[model samples]
Target: MGTYKQQSHVVWQCNYHIVLCPKYRFRVLTGLVKDLVEHDIKMLCQWKDCEVEELSVQPDHIHLLVSIPPKVSISELMGLLKGKLAIKLFKSYPQLKQKPYWGNHFWSRGYFVNTIGLNEDMIRRYVLHQEEEDKKEETNGKHFTLFD
Candidate 1:
């Protein structure tokens, strides 16, 4: 019953906590590069219709809490973000293509992702209370009515 986003055919509230690191975990995400990365990420998420609940960019890694629509898979989003961002950064700052990043990859090969949702205890309590209400309705010789 929390806030949800509606599409033409579906309503959803899928959220994810994502952690990504720079290739080789370098501290290259500093100064202008950091600013650009942050800006570009926001832009990309907006393009994907994803809402960024929280974002923290560190010198070596980034933590992002985002709500994404069900139509877009997480792997697809990650791939687009990482691949495009790297290309943009390399083009913007050719120096980034040097040394450790000579392989032309910016982000690490793997990232961490976890789903975010309501507290489990809260959901359990709701389920238990609903069962009790249903029992009461049955005892009253009345069936649950959607319109009512």
Candidate 2:
């Protein structure tokens, strides 16, 4: 049996995903989204102790596959990523503050965080495929307005 205890600063693969405003349902496009996701992921990866392997941004939410050191809590990781990304987003696109965004949130509250170890490949595929599944849901035409 392996111990669950965390070793200090040990690199642990982590995934964090969150949503944007519901207004993006029909208003946003996936083209520039790669730029947005890339910018943030690049910054996070450039930070002292974070490495982002895969990242994609859909109209509604963002999917990030990353590895972080043990010293950071999931909460801390989210805070740093969100705070930095939000500001960078607004600066990159000045219209972000004036238009109909996912409810003035810039970013949805709460996030989906998963710890990766043995099943890293499986989890990475799952996270990366979120956009494809989301696009496949046209039958229902249902959307999540608020960050759940």
Candidate 3:
């Protein structure tokens, strides 16, 4: 067998973002997200014991930059964020208990998460700029993904 690669305490810094469907965009999901998750959003930053570096909620999607420990995987972290919020929100409000809430789940199945390698500023700008670009695209009547 080949020698095993040594592992270090790798700080997994990542930027996560995702959007909702256009129909529901009319519902002002962003506003609702802020109202429904204002306090909880802070809590979510620490989901899975991960440290939240920044949090930005846009009109359609959310921008979450966090550094996760090696003990937890990115998918697991996302699950925790989406799961915890959905459970609490669904329990609190009956309106979101409706169908296809974020594609049969609390959050949209596919999300954009970028792994930080170098020049963190570039990555940060990309994450933040995505909100503006997406809004412009939506305003221009550009089509959304199939989920939309």
Candidate 4:
């Protein structure tokens, strides 16, 4: 269940369902790479004072249901998360620059975001079960497995 947050003159429960994919829809998210991505996402959310109610990282994309404060715009938050994650990933794995990938780009230029209104419970359930539902066959010899 989501809780209301009280500000100076507002009480809110602003939650959103956000989905993002890798650049060119590449299947590079697996094994250690997946772990790092998930960790970085949690760290970033915490830094932004946002709360992640549920998260699922697939082989090519990610699903997150998060509670954000009224003061922050969705685009600003998304940009920060995506930008910082790319920087960290690139730094941690310089070999990714060799082939099959290029430049400073990581995530795709666009994302899918929806506000959690009356369907908050339904959205939460969907996000929670996304891992099992989004499971894909191993690609590039990298097995797809769920990581906390």
User: What is the Cα-based TM-score of model 4?
Assistant: 0.77
What are the lDDT figures for the candidates, one per model? 0.91, 0.61, 0.60, 0.87
Tell me, by lDDT, which candidate is best. Answer: 1
lDDT of 3 by residue, 5-61 (tens): 223744344443432232344343566656676567667756466666666666566
Model 2 poorest 10 in a row by lDDT: 15-24
TM-score, model 3 to reference? 0.56
When 3 and 4 are scored with TM-score, the better candidate is 4
Alpha-carbon deviation at 112 in model 2, angstroms:
0.5
Using Cα atoms with residue i matched to residue i, what is each candidate's TM-score against the true structure?
0.86, 0.57, 0.56, 0.77
TM-score of 1: 0.86
- Clashes (N, CA, C under 3 Å) per candidate: 0, 1, 0, 0
Q: What lDDT would candidate 1 get against the real structure?
A: 0.91
- Pairs that collide, model 4: none
**Residue 72 shift from truth in candidate 3, angstroms:** 1.4
Rank all candidate structures by their TM-score, best first, as comma-separated numbers. 1, 4, 2, 3
Candidate 3 backbone collisions, by pair? none
> In model 4, where do residues sit more than 4 Å from their true spots?
119-148
